[model samples]
Target chain A: MNIEQINIKKSIQIYDELTKGRIINRHIYSSSTHSLIDNPLFQELRENLDIYTNQYQMSGHELIDDGEYFYLIYKKLESSTNQLIKTKVYSAIIVLVRCVTHLQARLYESIKNVNYGIEIKEINEIELPEEYLLILEKAKLGTLDKAVEYLADRSFLIKTNRDKYVLSNAGLSIVDEIVERQNG
Target chain B: MINYKSTIKYIVDYDEPFASLVEYMDQHSVTRVPVVFFELQVKQLIDKITKGTDRQIIDAISKAYALRNLKQHNFVTHDESNESIALTKFIEMFVRNMSEKMRVKPITDKRFKAHASQLTNILNEANSYVSKTTNDKANFREYLQDFLSEVKQDFESNKRAITLRTDNLSKLLKSSEAHGDQRLIYTKIVELCERYVEPFFQFISHTQDKNGFIPTMVRLREFFAEQEMLDEEAEVGRFILNFSSYTKDIQHVYDRINDYRRKGQQDLIVFNGFEKAFNHLSEIVMGMQDGLLVRNDLHNNQDFIESYKRFDNIKADNEKHGNVSINYTDLIEHFKNIEKDLVFSSRRSSQNSPLTQEINLERLALDKESASLLRARNQKNKQLILKISKLIKLHFSSFTKLEEPMDIIGDIHKILSAHMDDYRPFFTLYAYTNIRKKLLAIEKQGRIRVCVGYDQRKTFAYNGISYKYRPILIQDLT
Candidate 1:
């Protein structure tokens, strides 16, 4: 293949990553994964993803530039076969994030500006719904551990320590999307 | 028998008019009918619902019964007419309670009786203030200061008592599942609820002069009774809401006290921010008596009062992002609600200072840790699909049927399903289309010659059984 052809291939590879619900933070991914932060090929994809893929009919998936990271938001359709998240797991995650935020804001101890990474011990202090009992039991790493890990695995949260995870921008965006769905 | 809230909800659910055609119905109910008798009733319910109920309930009921369907419909339904009749029948009961022998049923839940009586006592004391007939009219500012001091004293004394009781009650609620003590949990819930719910009467009783405080007190009463109707299982949500609501009040009291002690302007800027929102709401609601009801989402969402409970006494411009970020939609809504204060309910400042504008909004930023996590997930998901696609290719390579397309993918699906047991995220049954879509795109680009075709067919086993499936074939796209 010619150099231009190879660049086009690289762009598709980048598109594939986003299509799977993964976020491409240019600053990090350029260094860690592709080393293509300023590379013409990756930059081309970053700048013009929708233009090339507009013909492919991406099942209502759109490339969203939330200004922090790049990812695909699947506009959820009732009959569309893309079933990525379970409702119970989603609810548990939202509840966990709320608990962490509520505790940090309310408790505000001697330490200031500590990352809102919640330990299972701290997570246990907040009240959650009864239906969550089943979800916790289904979690392989015990309820709280599995709960955080599931979000981390989905790129919704990032594991900071053995006991704590921080919600990612992607996670917050997903939650924002969930709330919009709920509102509509 | 008299759930005043339920009756009002019944009318508003149906009667609130939509766009234009039947818009007169919104006014006609109060102007033309006996429904005006319950004008005070509807106003109280609208307050309780928007400001007092859980966000989940508010969101659910509002969306399910939004004002869209009432465009051409009459304001009152047959059921509401029935409810209106029932409401009139109960006027004597509401009045009789004001006098000695109201003749209501004694609460069967013994847990609530103590707190209920305490509420009655506070009500009696505050009610006497209205009848005091002072020679000189009490200054509103002086009156509020005195009431605050009393409330602060009351809170300080009961802080530990309420904490200890609620702590024990929540523990009982958690353990009730394993211990099978449903009744025990129920009573504890009632007791915990009563401890938090009754103090509002003290505010409502004396704060008749304080703008918007009495209406809030009325909503708290309805919210408390609403809590009473919930079973032990469902009451957990209400239980958390009660604690949140109380803590919000305590936080406000603390902030106001701090402001008063600071002895600066003590302009009651933040306090009156809330006061004005409430004052404005009361004016709009009171206007409903004139049969001029211009409906909108009411002001002073109680959630906002609770949210900035600490910052409420300070200048609005100084409001800042403290420590953590709330990711949910409600947080966004809470910030938007900063507009409802009606104190600085002015045009948005070009600078958008937290103080001068409605919401001191911050754009959520992705941290390095989160960014790295997302990048790693992308690489991993890519690798997963690549490996699964190879396995699928190898399975399809043993294609013996060159005569026509064969139903080979179904058996491949069963094999992939078992092989991808640990691959929960990647290998979903629903993603058969996703996998196929990717494979076809690759084929169209000539990167791979993998073939996928589809057909719905009635199937027959070689021996006896027959079934149907959305059958498909796989081969090299040669």
Candidate 2:
């Protein structure tokens, strides 16, 4: 597909946001940004995903469209980037595991359903094991607030309220990988 | 004659004390309270009203005794012990009716069958008097009326008992307190299912058996309808109307029980799934901690640095291939490396960088030794898997010859015990998954049948980690 077939300006805006390491999920962002999933540019990108993939590939990033969200990963992982990724993965695992064991939530339901959005207070109230705390501290997600902030910044979690969060599709994708690994 | 008005007034004026006493008796399932205890409680209340002297306490006690003796009040009676105050039937029933606590009185199967037999006897006696004189007909009507009233009371009590029990069970299952103690929750669920739910279902199931509660009720309704048709009496019509209402109430109760059963089954599934996830996560975390401890003991800072150097070399080699996509396994490896860096870096000064750190000869030698030990462990795991797989294959062949369904875990455990000294459930699960995969492939052809018994779960523990899986049955068709 020709890149010019799509709206050049809107496509560039999406590319610019992806390059900044922000995942564009189906959920609407703040007043400054629109939900890409609902945008016409997203429809065009879906139609011409290869075009966008090649576009991002030129900038040392791989565009990943996980059905409900779009994100980019570094092709050649730098040490700092690898460290960031590790921290995110660890924090996600910690949060999700606590959500299941502490709150009695199903793994998929907690991730997929909005009604099952986790309350920050409830997650904070769960007394994690010493080992888990140590890992979370190492990851700089020692507090639930900091973890929420970090994850929200990356669009892994969408804040439904001041104290509630639902997993974005990007977050679910990471958990899906973990679950697949666990099953294997 | 005792003054009924003043006696009621006294009881009402001391309602708090009376209510407390009644509640205590109800909870303890006792009809009597010690006179000393009752006086002590009343004395406390009297003291609260005024700084009561001994004389005032005695006067209060005298008033209580007078009220107990009043035939109109019928609140309490003196037991043979005379040291205790026994509650009269009136007050006992009154307090029970007013109290919020619904104590579920479970009706045993024997009791239920007895009730059914009594109903059948009443039906036969009523039938025998149908053609007799006016007096006999009147006796028949009276008998039927008494039976109807008794059955109605029984139905109400049964409905309340089952409803309250189910609600309590549901609350317990959902309660956070019960979530922590899964064994307790499981026990309660089993109790609810066996002691209450299963029996209630059996009693109500009209289709499965002709002698169930519903069928018996249907027969009673038919008798009442037949009598109403033959006699053309308003009383018989009332009986028919009453039975119809009872049917509606029974339907409501049945719907509630059905809903509760469905929710209970769902709760069980969710509970099991969460338990499995929790166990799996716990196992992984424990394994990670164990691995970290072992590595920490075996490898020093310099060994870690050398390993990182090797890792960097591998990374560089991968980079040469142009744009490598990282998977979960690679991400986990990277995370482990980061963890190691954090562990060792803390011991060193916060300011000192990895590049500036000097490598010692002894630590370099330890790194190579650690590398060789990891390789040996991997090799041992592989050998164990191969041995387990072979034993499983041998067992499956024997089972095929015998034409019997295999108890996968049980039979495999026996085979492993007879053949190998070293056995782990983890290795067995790995081998089982492999065998299952192979059988599934072969099952695609019309040569064999593979069935996973989801209802039957087999569990085994190794090194304090529990593994649960469904049994798989394979049958050779050709």
- Which candidate should be chosen as best, given DockQ against the real structure? 2
TM-score of chain A of each: 0.51, 0.72
Query: Judged by lDDT against the true structure, how good is candidate 2?
Result: 0.57
Most accurate candidate by TM-score: 2
Interface RMSD of each: 19.3, 9.9
Query: How many steric clashes between backbone atoms does each model show?
Result: 2, 0
lDDT of 1 at B22: 25
**Candidate 2: residue B180 lDDT (0-100):** 48
lDDT of 2 by residue, B25-130 (tens): 7579786777777767776776675654466544654475453444346677766566777767566555454555635355555655666787677656656656
Q: Name the TM-score of candidate 2.
A: 0.41
**Which tens-of-lDDT digit does each residue in A88-170 have in candidate 2?**
44344545545554555343344345555667677667766565554454444556556766676666777763346666766
Q: Choose the strongest candidate by lDDT.
A: 2
